[model samples]
Target: MALLNFSQPLISDETIAAMADTMRTGWIASGPRVLEFEQALSDTFGGRPTRTLTSATGAMEVALLACDIGLGDEVITSTQSFFSTMNMIVKVGARPVFVDCDLISRAIDLNQVEAAITSRTKAIVPTHFPGALGDMDALYALAQRHGLRVIEDAALVQGSEWKGRPIGSFGDIATFSFHPNKNMTTIEGGAVVVQDEATARRIEVLRFHGIERLEDGTRDVVVASGKYNMSDVSAAIGLAQLRQLPAFLAQRRQLADRYFEKFPQIEGALLPPRGVAGQSWNMFCVLLPFASLGMTRQAFRAALRERGIATGLSYEPSHLSTLGRSLGYREQQFPNAERIGEQTVTIPLHCGMTIEDVDRVCDAIGEVIGSKKH
Candidate 1:
């Protein structure tokens, strides 16, 4: 039996062909294909100004630069997300003020976010947990009232919507990832959607090493920045992937449904939220009762591997990392995130997965944890 990998990207033949075409054109660097992909994404986000970048990390950093959020400014964000969310804030010389995630949804707690905000708070960076969104209405209202810029960490929620509005469509600034394991793939790329053309133009310069074009066709570097441009090769793949995103999301949702239905009713094993239809269903994560099962997460994963299955940890609590420690974060600072980080496992749920695949994973999990229950 083939190992059911935790996550996989669906790269169709057409996507490969598009990549080949871009390579043959010899304009594989950031060029027309990148422009096309950016335009397509802009249209997808309700005509917001969009720019493609090398990664979502770059997008977030650039967004911070565009918003002038650096030097003693505090950026409020979740402690439950990938380290890049906090790292970007620090990269721009800003302070990252973290709030613990909600136990159920894994989104940042809005009340804590409000409490974390102080006089130095310049922006709010909220990450939507895989396929699930926090209270956007409340989040934005709070940000608006505080005159804070909101940069959504939308890495895993490309097709997700909030109350019928697309995630990036009306947000202040939203960054998306096209990493291979995401709902869509550009092999490796990301995009930023902004409210206006000026921010978009600034990002263009920021992404391409801060080189502003002069009238005589010469480029001048007004600010120090690194190159974070997306090549046409990646963009070609992204354009093809974007075209199939809806179908991909539908498949993911179906797989998620199967996981929910087939998952065993083990006591203390917390299931993820049964997200709404608007959710993009990026990956299915479950928090297992490892201590009760008499196994560590490592041992449980080893058992899954022995059963020809693969499992992954979506994240480790950023606040407990070495970097987080250097910044004065300590153990138990964010209990929910620390708990979820230790116990959460990402199971297979991808466009390439079949309903039977979900059943196989569910069965393996049942065997591994269910039978081991105290």
Candidate 2:
């Protein structure tokens, strides 16, 4: 049996051809293609101002910078997310006030978010975990009540929506990832959608060395910054990927449905929330009964590997990392994030997977868990 990869990008011939055409243009740096890609992204987000960068990490950093969040300011966010989520807060010279995630959806708990707000709280950075969103209604309401900025970390939820409104379309600031494993790929790029053109201009300046083009063809450094612009080569590939995103999301949903139907109900296994509205289903992760079955996650993965199946650890608790600890976070501070992080595994589910692939993975998991329980 072929090894069932946990996540795989479905790059088409059109994407390769577009990349070739871009390289042949002799202007592979940020150029027309980048502008076109940005425009297309803006349209996708209900004509919101959009900008592309090298990575979502840069996108979040730029969003924070554009909002003028800096030293001594507090940004409330979840502890369940990827390291970059917290790292970017620290990168922007702001304090990241961590909150625990919900037990099932893995979204940041809004009540804790509200409780953690302080006078210094300048922003709320909420991540849509693996395409599942938190309560946007309450989150934005809280932000509005407190007069805090909202920078949505929508990296895994490119096509996700909230109550019929698109994620980036209605949010204050939303950042999306186009990494290889995401719902769509720009090869290696990310985009940010802001509320207005002024902030968009600020992001553009911040992304590329803070240079403001002067009228006389001279360049002026308005503020010191770094290069994070997406190349035309990446933009060209992104254009192609964007065209297929709707279909890609549909495929992911179908695969996820198969997982829901086929995965056996082991007593202590914790599955992700099903039938979520507006979920793009970027990944289908589950918390297996590793501890209950007397098996470590490592051992469980190895068991699947023996069956020509691959598994992935979606995340470990970011708050338990060295950086988080240094920030005064202890082990039990965020119980839900800690528990999910320790036991979660991302199974095979992507645009490249079929229903049969989902079934194979489910069968293998059932075997692994069943054998361990015996």
Candidate 3:
């Protein structure tokens, strides 16, 4: 059997051409191209202000800083994350308090979040898990009622929508990633979109060493911002990807459909559920029936790799990690988060895959889950 890699980027001739254009301009870093890319994203996001960054982690840090959240302050985030969310909170001198995921939905439970909040709570980051909003309206409403900032870690949701609004459009502050593995790619990049102009300026300044310079060949215009500006090359690639995003999302949805249709019931393997909720389908993950499977999530992943397929877990639960421990988050602090982190398997889903590719991967999953049965 020919081995098909789990996931790959969808860069095309246009992406190369954009890179070539950036090379031809001789202004590779923070040039006109980045501005153009930002404008395109803003327009795509219903005119919301989106500032490109080196990575979503940086975006998250800057957004939190802009909101004036820091030491003695606490930010609420769920256990499902790439660790960067909690890390960012710590980076800004703030503490990260974790809550559990809704067992069936895998979204953060609103009640737990409400219970975690105290006077020191400054922000709430509701991560858009696997492309679904995770009850965004309620989270937003909660933040509004509490007067806390909301910076959504929507790294997995590029074209995902919430409550008829684009996920990036309505939050108090939002961040997203353009890593090669995400729904779209600028190779490795991110953006911070703010709800107000003043806050947006604060982010721009904080990202680029606080010394902002306009990319105009003019020598006198400086914006005194952080080193957060995107390179023209990266921006060009981002624009190219943006143009292909809608189509990419459609293809992902198609692949997910195949997974849903051909899914075989394995006692230990649980299919992701979709009710009125929709996923950005960023990653297709499933929980293993641990009791029957007799393998940890890591063991299961290694087992799949032996079959020449790639699989991974999106993250380790924040409250259970070393960094979390140093910050005083004990294992018992977030039992549900600890459990989800141990079991979730983030299988690959990217545009460079064919339906046959998806089936091959899906069959491999069934085979693994059925092995114990046999």
Candidate 2 residue pairs in backbone clash: none
What is the TM-score of candidate 2?
0.98
lDDT by residue (1-374, candidate 3, tens digit) is 55555566889999999899888988999979988999999987789888999899889888888888888998988877788988889888888888887654567878999999999998888787664557777887898899988888888887877767887877687799998888888888999888877777777778877754558753432433346667899999999999998899889888887887776676656656654444577778766667557766666777778888887775678777888777777876666566666677777678888888777777887887778566
lDDT of 1 by residue, 327-355 (tens): 89998889899989988999888887899
How many clashing residue pairs appear in each of the predictions shown? 0, 0, 18
lDDT of each: 0.90, 0.89, 0.80
Off by over 4 Å in 2: none
Per-residue CA lDDT of candidate 2, range 50-104, in tens? 9999999999999999999999999999988889999999998999999998988
TM-score of 1: 0.98
Which residues of candidate 3, in runs, are more than 4 Å off? Answer: 1-3, 212-226, 275-278
- Give the true-structure RMSD of model 3: 2.8
> Judged by lDDT against the true structure, how good is candidate 3?
0.80
Shift of residue 178 alpha carbon in model 1, Å: 0.5
